[model samples]
Target: MNDKLDLQSTDITAMNIDKIAVLFPNCVTETAEGKKIDFDLLKQELSTEIVEGNKERYRLEWPGKREAIVTANIPTTKTLRPVREDSVDFDTTENIYIEGDNLEVLKLLQESYLNKIKMIYIDPPYNTGNDFVYKDNFAKSGGEELFESGQIDEENRKLSPNPKTDGRYHSDWLSNIYPVLKLSRNLLKDDGVIFISIDDNEVHNLRKICDEIFGESNFIGCITWKHTQQSKNDERFLSRQSNYNLVYSKNILITKNFKFNRTEEDNKNYSNPDDDPKGFWRSGDVRSPNLRQTLKFQIIAPNGNIINPPDNGWRWSEEVLKNKIQSKEIIFKNDNSGIIRKIYLSEQEGRTPENLWDGNVFGTTRIANSELKELFGDNVPFDTPKPTGLIQKMAELFRTENDFTVVDFYSGSATTAHAVMKLNAEDDGNRKYIMVQLPEASDEKTEAYKAGYKNICEIGKERIRRASNKIKEEKIDKAKKDGLFSEFKDEQDYGFRVYRLDSSNMQDVYYKPQDYNQGTLDLFADNVKEGRTAEDLLTQIMLDWGLPLSLPIERKTISGKEVYSVAGDSLYCCFDDGIDEAFAKEIAKEKPLRIVFRDKGFKDDTAKENVKQLLKQLSAGSEMKVL
Candidate 1:
């Protein structure tokens, strides 16, 4: 029995929600925005998850998936070593080229660049039968990696081909990629996005992982890019000519702001036939998609000919039709067989980008290979590299400002890097890039090895060098012809700093000082490795301080001791052999925001304290430390 009460004017939605809450109070919840209900909680209240004998309604799983999760969370003690000889602009460039394992590199960068990267575009191995999967070995120390860099022979490489004959073909590929994606998601800003390229071999699995990593709601779209122009006769059945670029955003609840401007051909469709004041106009069919008996009527054309309504019906009601006709917006053809509604060109916001990126609009594999071959003087080692135009199209949709940063961990042949530089040259933007590549050794039997390239990273570095020089040269030629380079002369920054992942500069004592016995305690004095240079220690210290490796550095002598000033005195390091109070006062006089002095540089413990106290006295706002 229920108590009867007088009914009142109320909201149907609130009443229905109250009824649900009365029956199941657990389903109701209050969100930060307002009172709301969690659908997942409601499902739990209903116990629908176990409706079919405890089976999951939907999920994607595979063997070793748990291991992948564990691997992503595992901590590492690695540091990046600055390689000046291998860098284009070792001290000034804002771009970075890292030669090492991408997963380890991403892990080390987590603190320094967390939630900072704007866009990422990676062309990873598609897990095809012949593709190579990274054999993630967490046991290997960073020192081991440094020693084995660029010498990844067939037997020693931490990679193996995943042929279909292998029992865990798909599983191995999944494990190889799962950790990298998980780590990469941590590096994206709130509005950041990642574009992953894959073929049919693993597109489905990749989508599942991406959905889990970047919530399903953040899925932007799966773009179908035409990779090849012609049909392949070698295919057994369907001739596949396209691949997918799965895009996901860190947060898509925000506005997309994606706009694809109409081409000249599209604008040609509009014409000012009557020379209207609102500019050119185009005629469209004046029919609605929905039909109703009220809209089913006959019309009389301007020529006195009767015309019946379309099957769908007129787009406007009787009153609306009369208003349009009075305004002269409803135009009749010369023959008067039909009617049309005029659409002004001013209201158009260009065409929206579709998922299908035709090969003609962007370049195909044939064109890409030809371009690469011509650029490299007839040696295109890569089988399929994305054309610069294709990447530029998507790059513009995301970031176009000077502060924008694009990351490409799997930067094969550095096409994305080339595209970034080209976009900067075209738009005069100062975009930064981070390119990471494994020094995967080339087999002696391959043409790349015979062409004087020892590893894949060599090819990628050379490509960036050639592309940067060419872009600069093209800009100079154009500026010279147009005579408009008053400000553009010194604005181009087409250089990158090269850093390789290696062991920490701090010797074993830095990790656990208490574990050293009397015999090993003597070795702990000046714990940095023997061969490590001042630059190497400076690089590690920068990482520990969460500073970007791309910051500009300046070297000068202070009181007869060499000091490296990073980012215009944002951080200063004096890794010299000796440090007296006189030298410390000289460094303090410069007033660096953050400064580090070598512990061994001091004559004694009292000398270190005197220098630290004098620095705090000289510049109270500065942070002073001794390593």
Candidate 2:
């Protein structure tokens, strides 16, 4: 009787089919499942220079490649249920923390966050044989050892080992990350970027896969981050002290130039010794970097001393050099030996970011361990956690926008969240973070479990909480020391909303309505699952409606019926029973842009039709949907 809400994640396969149908309508045909692309016919249509029949091509592939692709395209009925009890500032915070499998979580986010994220930074598993635990069809038959060892469970959602003894050691890791990367690409804006951390063991393979996913042309160079300075004497050859962060942009043409904020150390070279109009200037080389005959010239100083050009050439031509000298941009030494070009501090943008990062600027592993120790008091929650400074530096490279979003799927210890908050507090920028981490269980014998942290998500959430307080205390201490305590305004967001991925709220009968008969209707009266709260249904509805979960929500009573208003009437929802024409008319007077209701709320068919017609007449532009 009413338009039902599509309570499912975005169907990527359908979208691909629609795209193909637009280009090749003749190759699209209706099937029992739905509209499907006729691949054979489509291939024939593009047969001009098309490779087929196992022709060799440049690609990174492995077993189950097709299955991985299918996994990315498949739609999910799963949804993120709000966990307000575990969240901080649940009603107002823009930051989010989701606990779930990254792959499924990425699928659920396809619609609401498509092309919305400004940047992504993930330190995924380096796959040193024992780190891989993602269970998928990539090595189903070869996981006998893992199955016998009790690594995999009935739901296939637990951590399963991908041992090196297995034949598909690298293949399993590839398959696990491939679909996640594909789904992540959809969430990046046109000018967005992603930084992936890896080690020597899988850096080569990671780069190849990233090149394929983000396009070879969009490769933005990898940074070798030195995480430690100490050398291990027990190494087989040499002690490795550095890892890599492969950078890529969604589109290279629109990506901004990477740079870091200029620090006090970077500006120490500039001075106003000459007291020129420019604030501060540093001497720059006036010689050309490469040989050029036209630039080879001589210049006369104010003391009638002619100085010969450098071996290669002068940086500027004769006339240009004369103009620069006239403008006093070029000056001679006290002895009139050579000319010096003045590089003013005011003219510089920032320090150019290098491919090699080291020292405390990027934070060492020792410092990271110490940071955890300081927060947790010797009982460190995680081993080898990344430093907040490291992620902060990576975020600084994005000099374009300040009010951007950063996502970290492998948010071990929530370092990315802490870094974002720290950066925001430092500069008063509006940067938000979305952390997605699988709740890998902590061993009972480990310190984390002894500290009452049952899983990785628990550690991540607690870290964020403690880090938030620590950052706030530091800010307060600095403000008081500077005698600016009263004037200081802490605008940084030190809170995040928590959501856990779970099965859909809809019952099995909701998806299979045709399977029920008139006699079976009594057993399946309510389509929604039992114990699902109104907030749970609202969350799913927002996702299905392609609305962000960060929007403001308020509950109000209109004509004795509770109505939920989102973002000031951008959406309105009421799942209560006993809805009649009076409530519909009253809610329609609010003129909501979108509204929803429970179909069973209506008393009879006539009442449902009457309420629907009244809403249409009152709220002409409002879209009405039902659950």
For this target, which candidate reaches the highest TM-score against the unseen true structure? Answer: 2
lDDT of 2 at 205: 83
Query: lDDT tens string, model 1, 1-627?
Result: 348875977767666777897888766654323334657667776784643334455766666788989989997788889888878877778999998889888988888888888888999988877656557333344545543553233224445566764546777788889999999999999988899989988899999999999999999999999877898899899999999999999998863656666678878889997888878899987888787768777888877899889898888897888788878788777789888788888988766678999989877888778768867876666666889888888777753245688999998788888888988888888889999998776667776777888888888888889898888888878887898776557476788898988877878654366776877877767768889899998888888898888788899988888899988878999887767788877888888999987778787888888888888898776898777
Q: TM-score for every candidate vs. truth?
A: 0.81, 0.85
User: How far out, in Å, is residue 34 in model 2?
Assistant: 37
lDDT of 2 by residue, 225-323 (tens): 999989889999989999999999999999888878798999999999989997899999988899998887777888899898888898888988989
What are the lDDT scores of the predictions, listed in order?
0.81, 0.86
Candidate 2 Cα lDDT to native? 0.86
